[model samples]
Target: MYKVTVYVTYKDSVLDPQGEAVKGAVHRMGYDSVENIRIGKYFEIQVSKDEDDIEQVIEEICDKLLANVVMETYRYDIQEVEI
Candidate 1:
């Protein structure tokens, strides 16, 4: 079996309103030290070892469903597990 951890985030050129809002709230709460904040998504996927190419599978899924390639970017980490 394989375990995949995916992280999806807005592109650097894209504005992150949610992250901005949270940063504002943090400032109000007296945490001025914060420079900025970026909101993102995380996904965990499990695949059978029978999948000949785990990396390829993960990349396709991330491109199609896990992220919006135009405005967002994605990265993933994979680990093999004992069946």
Candidate 2:
């Protein structure tokens, strides 16, 4: 078994309007120390594939669909676990 952790976020060069709006709201709510905010997506996948193939499958899924390479970037970590 495998535990895959994926994080998808906008590239540093891209402007994240949603994150900015949230940051503004947070500041208004009395947390003025908040400087910057970049929102992201987190995914935890449980796969019952062979150990050797888990990494490849996760990478393919992230590159081809989960992340938009043009404007967003993603990183993942794969761990082997016995279920």
Off by over 4 Å in 1: none
TM-score of each: 0.96, 0.90
- Listing every candidate in turn, what is its Cα RMSD in Å to the true structure after a full C-alpha superposition? 0.7, 1.3
Model 2, position 38, has a per-residue lDDT of 99
Candidate 1 has which clashing residue pairs, if any? none
Stretches off by above 4 angstroms in model 2 are: 49-51
Q: Report the C-alpha lDDT of model 1 over 1-83, residue by residue, as the tens digit.
A: 99999999999999999999999999999999999999999999999989998999999999899999999999999999997
C-alpha RMSD (angstroms) for model 2: 1.3
> Each candidate's lDDT (Cα)?
0.96, 0.90
Give the number of the best model, judged by lDDT: 1
Per-model tally of clashing residue pairs: 0, 0
lDDT accuracy of residue 47 in candidate 2: 90
Q: How do the residues 1-83 of candidate 2 rate in per-residue lDDT, one tens digit apiece?
A: 77889999999999999999999999999999999999999999999865567778888898898999899999999887887
lDDT of 1 at 64: 90
